[model samples]
Target: MVQEIRWGIVGLGSIAHTFAKDLALVTGGTLTAVASRSLEKAKAFAGEYGVAHTFDTYDALFESKEVDVVYIATPHTSHEALSIRAMENGKHVLCEKPMGVNPDQVARMIAVAEKNKVFLMEALWSRFNPSIRKAKQLVESGEIGSVGFVHADFAFYALNRDPDNRLLNPDLAGGSLLDIGIYPIFLSYLLLGMPKNIQASSHLYKTGVEMQTSMIFDYEGAQAILYSGLNSKSEMKAEISGSEGSIFLSPRWHEAQGYSIEKEGELVDYNLPTKGKGYTYEIEEVHSCLASGKVQSSMWSHRNSVDLARLLYEVRQKSNIIFPFEQQKEGV
Candidate 1:
């Protein structure tokens, strides 16, 4: 039998809760520790997940010998510092998306991980979705016939809540583009690769953050029309059209339970049932890579994380959306 991989969750936030629940259903994985700034939250999370340890501080968890891998679920601004610290403590890291506020921080995290000879990955969970995998397979098999155009959007209304929430707080790197917008941006990179050129526009909130944003990614013969916002809901389905036909991801494409293919005037739909909050697949990938002694996954490597960060940084530049943390870097 394969030895179980012990995992630590650093941050008992909403997303962390989802990950912990999903970890329960995955083989070769167990939630061994949880950490949070608040002792109460950490203790509660540990009890709920039956985790063996709880730490009031992330540093405490990182130093725990029981945790072999640490999942960094903190805000975008804290990802780089926390992940690098975890690596320094000899722990593998799977950090949340937008890995950092910008490319520089991501580069630092990657450098630290490489220096430590530890495994590291950005938790872009959508890449592990079965429906997404099928879409990639269809495109690669020439079923899409030279993909030409792609369209995707992710949006929701979240402006009425606390103004201090992460979405509106520039200090926390808040904005639709970095938050909800990353889903569409990631989908574009997955199917279309990085665009050769780009143009973007945005509507800024009173808090000096982007409320809604749209962009067109231009390739040699293909283009991607993508949009994200915090003002309203969008259809959330994604389509990739080529010379022949297209693939349409079911509604809530990022968390899709199904997908459809339109080819030769025929339509076929597929259902993909997942075991948990859709995190089981990524957790499985982690287990497979660790068992093989691989440092980075071919599916989601350091290069992919860097490329995605650069693309977002460029897009934010075009949209004139700058995070306060970015300004701090410039000052330094």
Candidate 2:
């Protein structure tokens, strides 16, 4: 029998709480420890999750001999550093999406992971979503007959948030593109691959952060119209159209609970809801890869993460949406 994997969660925030709760439903995996900058916060999260270890410093958690993997759930700017440190400590890492602020940091993280021979995966939970999987299967099976266009958007109003909040803080890599824009980017990559040409526009807040971003991805035979925002709420549905038919994802498509395919004007519905915060699927994949001694995932490889980051970098460059950190980091 394969042994279970033990997890050490870095950054004890609300999202980490949700992740801890979901870990309860995963077999062969357990939340063994939690770390935060504050002892109080770490102890609180550990107590709530029934975790045995709680540390005030990330270094302690990363260096812990008990932890087999570390889930880097910190803010966007911190992801690269934390993942690299964990991997350097001989622990696998599942970092939250947009993996790094830019492609360069992502490249460095991948290199370190490869050098250390440790498993590393971006926490793009949407790829493993059942509805998304089903949609991909239909597309690959020729049910859609050569996709010509893909449209997806993820948006919600966040203008009321405080300037100090990560959503509005430029120093923290705060912006619609990194925060919510990644979902649309991921969908586009999944369907259209990397676009040969890219055009983008953004509406920046007075704080110099993007409030909304719209991107056009031009491929060999198809195009994708993607948008993400903190200015308005969208239907949040996704569509992939081809010569023969199209597939429509249910509302909140990124976390797809169901999807429908239309062919010759006939629509067929497929519903598959997930449990908890929808992280169990990726958790299972982590366990599977670990058991196989794989250093990266086939579904969300390090290269894929780097590609997505590079695309975002290009989009930001075109839209004049550079973050403050870009100036601090040379050659960003």
Candidate 3:
């Protein structure tokens, strides 16, 4: 039997709760510890997850011998610092997506992970979803021939959210582009490699954060049209068109539970169920990497995170959307 991989989670946010629940369903791993800024919140999460250890301070959790790996679920701006600290403390890290706000920060985090010889990966859970995996397989198998065009969107209305909420706060790197927009961007990158050209634009909220953003990625013989926003709801569907047929990842494609293939006047639907809110898949990937003595997931490597960050930076530049913290850091 494989030895259990001990897991620690920093930041007891809503996503962390879902992750903890999914961790319970994964084999070869257990949620050993959790931390939050509030001791009460840490204790509550620990109790709910049956975790053995809890800490009010993130550093305390990083220092705990009980945790072999730490999942950093903090906001976008905090990922770099927290991940670096975790690696420096000799803990492997699986940070939530948009690994860093910019390429430089991602490079630093990757450097620290390499220096520490600890595993590090971005938890872009969509990459591991069963439906998405199957879609990749079908595409690779030529069931869709050569992909030529892709269209995807992720959006939701958040106008009523308080101005200080992380989704709207510039200091926290709040913006549709970094938050939900990333999903569509990631899908494009996953299907089509780095684009030859990227054209993007955005509508900024009064707080100076992006409310809606659209992007067009030009490849050698293909193009990807993508959009994300916090101004209105969208169908949240994605389509990959090829010479032979097309594949559709169902609504909310990021966490897609099913997909369809269309060809020759026929449509085939596939239902790929997920375990425990769909986070177990990524957790299992981490366990596999650690068990194999690998420092990064081949599927979602440090380089991929860096490349994604760079792409996001380019998109922001084209859109003229800048995070307030970035401005402050640069003394702009």
Instruction: Give a tens-digit lDDT track for model 2, residues 194-226.
Output: 999999999999788999999999999999999
Which one is best on lDDT? 3
| Tens-place lDDT digits, model 3, residues 1-332 | 76689999999999999998899898788999999999999999888889999999999999999999999999998999999999999999999988999999999999999999999999999999998888888888999999999999999999899999999988899989889888888888988889999999899999878999989999999999999999999998899999999999998888998999999979999898888799999999999999899999999988889889989999999988877777887895
Cα-lDDT of candidate 3: 0.92
Candidate 1, 159-250: lDDT as tens digits: 99788999888888888988888888898899878899988999999999999989999998999999999999999999999999999999
Question: Which parts of model 1 are misplaced by more than 4 Å?
Answer: none
Candidate 3, position 235, lDDT: 99
Candidate 2: C-alpha lDDT:
0.91
Clashing pairs in 2: none
How well does candidate 1 score on lDDT at residue 35? 91
Which scores greater on lDDT, model 1 or model 3?
Answer: 3
Model 3 RMSD vs true structure: 1.0
Q: Backbone collision count in every prediction?
A: 0, 0, 0
Model 1 alpha-carbon miss at residue 318, Å: 0.6
lDDT of 1: 0.90
